[model samples]
Target: MNLKGKNVLVTGSEGFIGSHLTEKLVEIGAKVTALVQYNSFNSWGWIDTFDKNIKENINIVTGDVREYDSVKRIVKGQDVVFHLAALIAIPYSYLSPMAYVKTNVQGTTNVLEACREYDVEKIIHTSTSETYGTALYVPIDEKHPLQGQSPYSASKIAADKMAESYYRSFNLPIATIRPFNTYGPRQSARAVIPTIISQVLAGKREIKLGSLSPTRDFNYVKDTAEAFIKIAESDKTIGEVINAGSNSEISIGDLAHKIIRIIGEDVKIICDKERIRPEKSEVNRLWADNTKIKQLTEWTPKYSLEEGLTETVDWIKNNMEYFKTDIYNV
Candidate 1:
């Protein structure tokens, strides 16, 4: 499955990880069509930040993934489909669970159906660590029982199952790339890493956060993007669910302090009640067993947590204008 000359369609190409993956696909010489959610602003999200030369090489299409005709139209003639579009904010899901179902579940069904109709060579479906809510065991593996502690995670769980069913029922060439907390440039302020970095860069000595006890296995966005490519290129990955992660865990409190140290800031952490999730809804821990991805494809996390955080801090510092540090995003 050589991808260099193949046609690739990346849904959610305007977003954080999707933008990175789309750029990587372009660098690999793939004919790329990026599907960005349509808006009145005509904004391509982070794709709008690309240089002229890079943007020139891409065919950007505006359409909502929830629309079947829109998805089918963009999916035509594509050799590979990377389905990354979804409503991913956890808190917002609590406020609007049906939105999650509509976008995540039904939207993913749209991708799978369109790809099946188009007979795309391969489809890489994105899954999240949140689906494996508070780990029942250490270094969570693909075999771990899924616990949907939040509406966002529940929706993702349904999406993953939808992809699985497509593979089984329709023989769709699909693989699920489940990534643990991916963080880096262009990540929204709603995410923890950006939230912490944004406030500290805004000269806040006191950083407000949610639960500090929850542990997570964080992967840099670049590594996660590479995982998608590797999976797409691997013949062994079809009908598989592979985990992309650093395979190391860090508590939220420790992670915050590590970021503060990198920024050379003397910061005090405060527990914001408003930021906390309902007790049962909170995923207390997440650690990834990345053995499957490493075995099935040529992929490994290239950035250590400290190195990734340093780069993220640098990005947030320069892009501080994009963040509203005075308000809790969500």
Candidate 2:
């Protein structure tokens, strides 16, 4: 599954990770059609920030993944489909569970149907570490029993199962690419890394956060993007679920201090009750078992947590003017 000279379609191409993956595909000489969620303003999300060289090579398409006709139309004539469009915010999902079902579940169904119909060579369906809920054991692997502690995770679990059914029933050549806590530039404030950096850059001496006890396995965006390519290139990944992670773990309290240190700030961390999830819903810890992805594809995380956080802090510092740091972004 050589990507060079191939036609690729990346849904959610305007998102933090999707935009980077689009650029990487373009760099690999793949003709990429990027599907950005349509808006009245016609904004391309973070892709608008891409340099001319990267943007010119990509065929940008405006459409919603939840729309079957739109998804089918954009998926036509594509060799590989990277379906990443979904509602990702956990807080938003709690407020509107139906929206998550519509986008994450139904939207994924649309992409799978398109692939089955169009005879696309392969499809990489994006999954999240959230599906596994709080770690029941150390270094969670693909075999971990899924327990959806939030509406967002529940929807993703449904989406992942839907994709698996397609592979079993229709023999759709799809691989589920599950990534753990990917963070980097262009990340929204909904994510902890960006939230911490944005608040710190805003010159706040005190920062508000949710629970700090939970641990996460974070991966830099570039490493996750590269892992996607490696999975797509591997014949062994068909009908498989593979993880992309740094195989390292950190507690939120420790992670916040790490960011504070990187920003060179004397900040006080305050736990916001409103920001916290219900005790039953909170995922207490996550540690990725990267053995499957390592065995299936030659992919390794290139950036350490410190290195990635440094780059992320620099990005947030330079882009501080673009965000409304005073308001909590849900």
User: Residue by residue across 53-87, what tens digits does model 2's lDDT show?
Assistant: 99999999999989999988999999999999999
Q: Residue 273 CA error for candidate 1 (Å)?
A: 0.5
Residue-level lDDT for 15 in candidate 1: 94
lDDT of 1 by residue, 155-228 (tens): 99999999999999999999999999999999999999999999999999899999899999999999999999
What TM-score does structure 1 among the candidates reach?
Answer: 0.99
Give the Å shift of residue 323 in candidate 1. Answer: 0.6
Clashes of each: 0, 0
Candidate 2 Cα misplacement greater than 4 A, ranges: none
Candidate 1 lDDT trough over 10 residues, lowest sum? 298-307
Model 1 misplacement above 4 A: none
Q: Model 1, clash count?
A: 0
